[model samples]
Target: MHQIKSKLLLTGAAVIVAFSFGLNANAARMDMVDVSNNNGYMSTAEYVSMRNEFGVKAVTVKISEGGTYKDPYAASNIANVQAAGLYINGYHFARYATKAQAIAEADFAGQTAKAAGLPVGAVLATDVESQEANNQTKTTNDRNNTAFMQEIAKFGYRSDIYTSGSWANNKMTIKGKTGWIASYPYVATGKNWYSTNHAWQWSSTAKFRISYGGFDVSQLNSTYYTADQKSSVKPTDPSAVHQNNQTANKHQQANSSAKWVKESKTYTLKTAVKLRTGASTSSSVITTLPAETTVKTDQAIIQGGYRWVRQPRFSGYGYLATGPANNTLEYVKISVSNTYYTVKSGDSWWSIAQRNGLSMYSLAHQNGKSIYSTIYPGNKLQIN
Candidate 1:
């Protein structure tokens, strides 16, 4: 599941509105449809068709990618799926190489899901079958996976891991974790081949005699529908779900504003950056602009610990992060001057000189100031 942002996926909205409306936990089998950007913009009709024709009772949508990309269609697809009367869940494409990175990506996934309107208690699985992830040791992967899921728990969501059967068995251990395994069988069997796992992706080209492109289909068991299984792969009572939903709703309402600064300028991405619907990192991602890509911005904003620019779009505008405010690690380069560095808070003369590979005196002399002269944030100093 090394799917990029362009080919991400999602689930239905109605699943959470009334979890018991059309779902039975003790049923022998249930089907779930996972969708993303590759499926194109879906309609409520499509979700209805999925539910009625294919018996898809639940959906697991791709809500975010790595630590920065949020699927732009997630919000719309989630709404449509809900209207079609199917349960909804979420997944994230994992790209973290370290425990810290895993925690950050988990926070990003949690925030993206909440912002996209996924109700609390939804299972937010981490897709951990990326090549870079597989290259690492199993110990490292398991440790990081634990960190990712723990962070997701903090946002009032249950967690799972999505990976191949072989990887789930050998590359990492899901003994204590909820496992959603992917393994296409030679023959179409309603049974989960990986019986020990909670959910089994049985077909990549599944069709229930409906006229549509082949979709990845999976068999979900009773454990998949449980609302509050923080650990273990077994089903549990969801008595605390309502309280969690209320608490999470309060948290979202309190911290959902972005700070804006109107300014028009051209800039270049120093690193790959996600273009989002708003200035916040939790906002839906439109697309990713690779490093060195030049774009024109009509405004700028600071939110979620990073500075972002508002790039005008055909429909409205998209936000791209310039970088974090407290550090010199800028991802987007201001095009005003290539040979200058803008002073940011917490930056000292020596720190600035060190970052520019210059002596403090040399930097001070170039800027026509004493080495001991105090520098302030937003002051541009010549570096070349």
Candidate 2:
């Protein structure tokens, strides 16, 4: 079967079943699952759910494709899976037709896998079901496939070959290497179809009620995770993922050097505005402040073609734009304070001036009244 995948972008879903354990004739075998960016960002809870709800013993994440594309979610997925107490490995989609090309692609895949934190000596399988390989002669395909796996071996990783059962039986002869054969039966009961291979990918449309979509799944034999292989283990709290994110956000905030003018002011938003992490339109948004919301700002800065105002927060500063750099078409501005007040029974010029931040003489003069003028509650006075 030809498995088409986007060369650089995340697409589809597949699971590689893997586990590392000592070789024992009586050890109960476990299944492997594969994931790529198409699985989205898996949380530790989700990984735990997969383990508890569906019995996913181990995971193999797609690490890289071709020579230049590294799967964006590979590192995070590896970490989450490990944090959830599952063994982890990595795989790369291969596109090489010659020995030299295989070596080059293997080098790229090996380095990318390492950078993504796949433990050294974990199974690094080359997914060789691309259409480019189907067009090459069997000799060419086998020779270069061996070259690819051999090159990755130099990087201290155990190697395997992932291909369709038909390809393994017909088009390619990856002899002596562990095989991960993909063959979707009418019903995937986790039964091993290719008995000689180390792993059997029994279904590409396997779905569990706990997961949102279908996935490719495999049934792995003990050799897929032999005693010699290094397996991923939980090194920190799974919640540390969120902590790292918070730290990165702090780092991003610290990177800005905008000079803010401090002034306590309140403004009413004229339109919905984005609260950002930084003083730029391109910065990541924290939230959206709805129209007519009143917000207090302790500082403001002009940057990135906008007037950004800082709303002091206990965690850090959240910024929103007042308007464009030219200060036209404003989204928010200083709320108008009362300019006129009605005289109360006990109100005096001095009391009015103190409340309005004005001098007694200025308040009385603005209101056309003497400082000692007797006023009733209904008399209007210009407090400004």
lDDT (CA) for every model shown?
A: 0.64, 0.63
Q: Tell how far residue 332 is off in model 2, in angstroms.
A: 49
Query: Candidate 1 at 320: error in angstroms?
Result: 33
Candidate 2: give the clashing pairs.
14-34, 15-33, 15-34, 16-33, 16-34, 17-32, 17-33, 18-32
Query: Which window of ten consecutive residues has the lowest lDDT sum in model 1?
Result: 1-10
Q: Assess candidate 2 and give its lDDT.
A: 0.63
The ten-residue window of minimal lDDT in model 2 covers: 4-13
Candidate 2 lDDT score at position 64: 93
Give lDDT tens digits, candidate 2, residues 292-356: 88887777664443457889888998988775332232566435453467888888776765454
Candidate 1, residue 8: Cα displacement in angstroms equals: 25
Candidate 2, residue 130: CA error in Å?
0.8
Largest TM-score belongs to which candidate? 1
After superposition, candidate 1 runs with Cα above 4 Å error? 1-30, 208-211, 226-384
